[model samples]
Target: MVTVKMLKPYYIKADNDFIRVILAYQYFSVLIDEQVYQFVPTEAKEIRINRRTQKVENMGVRFAFQKGKDIAYLTMSELISLPDFLLQLDTIAQPYYFQEKTNQKNETAIIIRELEQLNLRRLIDKSLDERDADTFHSLTKML
Candidate 1:
């Protein structure tokens, strides 16, 4: 029954390596009539947890981002483009650990290795070498 209505722009932060992001200031699947949840990124430092009154706009939601020393209102665009995500953002309360997709790098490695076996990497390398050779060669010439 989950539809685009449930997708909304919820703020999320990039992980340590900037590979993935955790949804910011939102919650989902509560039991009580007014139960809520807030999720904090395990790796978040400057803004581990934020509290604010987010401003809603046609584009999406906006809110103040506050940690101990950092304070600003950040906007998340894509998910806000969806509806469902917005519903939860308006509803959830209290902080919780944002459950994120696990085993990312290991799985990424497997996929990359599979592509390499199929020679896709070499093809990409050729394209890069051809297109970027002028730039690289220019640097060499300068050296």
Candidate 2:
């Protein structure tokens, strides 16, 4: 048997957009402007890092889901918080991330580790709009 666990969802304001992120076992989903994008963590690829700005830029990472029918790209320009989020998700999605156990009745089980709640506000920068910042701040506090 396989079981899935998920962390609490958080809201992030990035590049003038509000995104709702839900992290789960093996996968993470994002709600962007009312559209939901679900992706497998292990499938995350096309990573590009910028050392000068210490950020991920120019479509640094791309996640494909639904048999490659859906895709989401993230680029951080001086938005420092995204790397951690991506790293955590990728780690858990790895094949070795899950453990197996056999019980007395010969039932096999798969267990997944719990993920920590992400501080979505950390992705926000001063360049964000004042109103959007206010909204994100309030939303973060409420969560």
Candidate 3:
């Protein structure tokens, strides 16, 4: 199962690709072109997968990378641009540069704080028609 999946490589080739898994959610799935793949992980003491899709053939496998280690993503177009010297890119190790900070951090915090509020006053104020109907009914009713 892929810890963190990328769609770039799979899109480059019509092979079986393992996408991602969520241990906390108890669910894992592989997708190609926005379609779920029915792939089964191989049991060879190594992280492997066999994908089965109609639009594509049943052939795509990605070995496991070291745990907690991340890889850099390269698009097919970018790969073509690399010189022959870069063909042997195995020596380079992709680092987790974003472990420090991400772009959406501040925006996410703002949304979470707004959602955590217990007050529904903002919602009620927005529906003026509903408020007017309730006020008129209360004034006319005896109790």
Candidate 4:
């Protein structure tokens, strides 16, 4: 029996349409019976995923799996039976997606704070121009 294990990608890049997993240096592994086969990327091959559907797009992409001197290329049929693996990969890539959202939130917060400060400064200026000592003091204290 074949059991897939240690299926990791070196890097995951996500965009609006797709998530690409760049494979490198023993990033994927599978166990066939008792032997552990490590699949290493020999050329430029990436697992392209549809961002909305979360489905693997490059089903024909193959990786050469090696166990000591024994080596073989994984077949398309075998690659097709990997929905669970893709789900695991999605979990691994979740933090990267969340990180982008977090950065956007932080940027929005910074802009809002800057606008509030600017408004307060304008109020302070108006109080100075009108010679309103109480309003000027209150606005400056808000700074």
Scored by lDDT, the top model is: 4
Candidate 3, after superposition: displacement of residue 15 in Å? Answer: 29
Q: Say which candidate scores most in TM-score.
A: 4
| Tens-digit lDDT string for candidate 1 (9-102) | 2445433332122344442221112322233333231212222223232234443333345443333464354466555554442223232322
Using TM-score as the measure, what is the rank order of every candidate, best first? Answer: 4, 2, 1, 3
What local distance difference test score does each model get? 0.39, 0.37, 0.29, 0.75
Error of 2 at 115 (Å): 36
Better of 2 and 4 by TM-score: 4
Q: Estimate TM-scores for all models.
A: 0.21, 0.24, 0.20, 0.57
Worst 10 residues of 2 by lDDT: 108-117
Error of 2 at 40 (Å): 2.5
Model 1 alpha-carbon drift over 4 Å, by segment: 1-59, 65-74, 78-100, 120-143
Model 3 poorest 10 in a row by lDDT: 88-97
- What are the clashing pairs of model 4? none
RMSD of 1: 16.4
How well is each residue in 27-108 modelled by candidate 2, as lDDT tens digits?
Answer: 4444545565554554543333332232344444445433246655533321224445555434433222212311321342
lDDT of 4 by residue, 1-143 (tens): 67678878788887877788887767788887768988866643577877555566777767788888888677645765777665677776666453555577689999999999999999999999999999999899999
